[model samples]
Target: MATKPEFLLIGPGGVGCIAAFTINYNHTANVSIVVRRDYETVRKHGYHIDSVDYGKVDGWKPENVFASVEEASKSGIKFDYIAVSTKNLQDIVPVEELIAPVVSAHSVVVLVQNGFGIEKPLFAKFPQNIVLSGVSHIGSHNRNGHIHQMQSDHLVISAFENPNVDADSQVAAANRFIEMYSNNINKCVYFASAKWYRYRKLVYNACLNTTCALTGVDTGRLEAAGGLEAIAIPAMKEVIRVAKADGVELPDDVINVVCHADDGDYFEPSMRVDVKKGNPIELEAILGNLLDTARKLKVETPILDLLFKLLTVVQFRLKEANGYVGVPEKRPIPDTFFK
Candidate 1:
């Protein structure tokens, strides 16, 4: 390991930027962010963040910024961790192809993304490297290319349970990673079962994210328009049921907490923002993956099934509105990844 932990954070959107800011603000680790669109602007002015919780920070630059992972990888610098906030790129490019140049034999790979089965391809390639799954409860979004910090509790974290990998090493690496990040933001809770962590976050994403996207509103508006009871609550119920079928039990009152987030903590989720911007939403990762798993488990998610069909229609329409014709490529999941 290097004397100081360095990270290559891919996809500097809401989720990615918050993590980048938290670490960079606390000066916890040296962060190298991949600035895909606004390289020059970010390199010069950095970002101006407005927040209700994290306070305001104007013009903060990370340690290093690269246009792409390939560019960063060629710097002859191996990062201790690679944090990805986008959908898994197994279909577009192999994980090894993307991060091989930036990692050593013992690099810890952590993905703070929303979805299921995010670890399969990574484990398939790097059977010995530590792999972790993170669940972010942050109610934040990006506005005019800056992260808007809203509210959050604990960031649920866990390393995946892989039979082929050394379990003890994974736990130790996870604890070390969490320790490096404990100085900033909020609490970092280490959950032993990454499987359970992923599904529980899906309870909110599969319900609120999709509901807000389809209705063209934020969580608070959805609750105001009565979509909370008419839509969100039922969808969460389906999520709980499917989670159980997959052998993860959830609490009975999760619905109340999931729907009514704090009183003024209403912000458009990334899904709603993506739909409005005519960009392809993370439908597959947040919704498609869940529906697929529900099917494998033979769990009947009537509400979720309906919302899935409806959201796909809205997603297609939004893409068309943006003049994007080609459908996004989907990844084929292996049966071995399932529990």
Candidate 2:
């Protein structure tokens, strides 16, 4: 009999735990996870999940769990799909370096994170491997070993073209992943290109995520302060303009859909949560990269530019507190390091 395909997920945060749960729930492949802080708690007690879509499932564990990717690499298993659902904080460490130990030539790297230009570095690092870009719209948070998934989950995935790898092989790997991962309970759709979805998501994120972090408020508070109309909507319009300049034209109605996305049921975005915990936010991947593209395309984005500048100060404070001072040195790994 043919062996079942192997799947591994790094970063068992809110998003990572839920994805691992659902993928293991499907039981189409062998699922494994690499967890850091909560490894002991999870390995002993397992995950306590309360999801609206999947309902309550306590003491849930994947087939195998490890403390780190380096540990998982020594398990004598070649991973078919390695999904990363961590925050895209490239300043701290590149995603490419984090999962380098287990990325085989046959393995497909799936990025289930936010921000623009996130897939570029991974592609450059693993041109021989197929890299898939994923944009996840899920509302979940993990406190200790307990996870709460308040909103329904939706993931849009697409393969990033690699000149070194052929097109047919890339699509085949992507389809295999979707086949094993997607089910009747959770939604994961395959799109032709994930660029449009990335831009559309920023219509909500670049405005509310940044503003909430700076002002230390939630969505309802921002709307109550007239920021929904004054700050969020206008900034979303600028994002649409920038997307248009970059060849992805977003509809005008997206402003209304995104601005009032959380009308009465409002919660804090990830950036605000990071700010509350004094963690470094994804400053470069989300706003800085978008603004760089705007400047190159000659698109006017005064609102986003101001938000970027102010958020940079917030980021500097977090970095200073963590003592990440001065320029970072280049971290070089062997080109043939993958198994």
Which one wins on lDDT? Answer: 2
Tell me the whole-model lDDT of each prediction, alpha carbons only. 0.77, 0.87
Tens-place lDDT per residue, model 1, 1-339, is 557788778878777788887777666688889887777778888887877657788887788999888889877678888887765534334455676667678678888877777677677777777887777777677655687877753576799877777788888888987887666457777898998877877878888889888889988888889998898888888888888998999877777766655458787877887788777777767777788888999988888888889977876676667665555568556669566
> Cα deviation in Å at residue 49, candidate 1?
4.2
Per-residue lDDT tens digits for candidate 2, residues 102-124, read 99988889989988878778888
Each candidate's TM vs. the true structure?
Answer: 0.81, 0.89
User: What C-alpha RMSD separates each model from the true structure?
Assistant: 6.5, 7.3
Model 2 error, position 200 (Å): 0.3
The parts of candidate 1 lying over 4 Å away from their true place are 25-28, 49-59, 87-104, 139-154, 220-227, 262-267, 320-339
Cand. 1 TM to true fold: 0.81
TM value for model 2: 0.89
- For every model in order, what is the number of clashing pairs? 0, 0
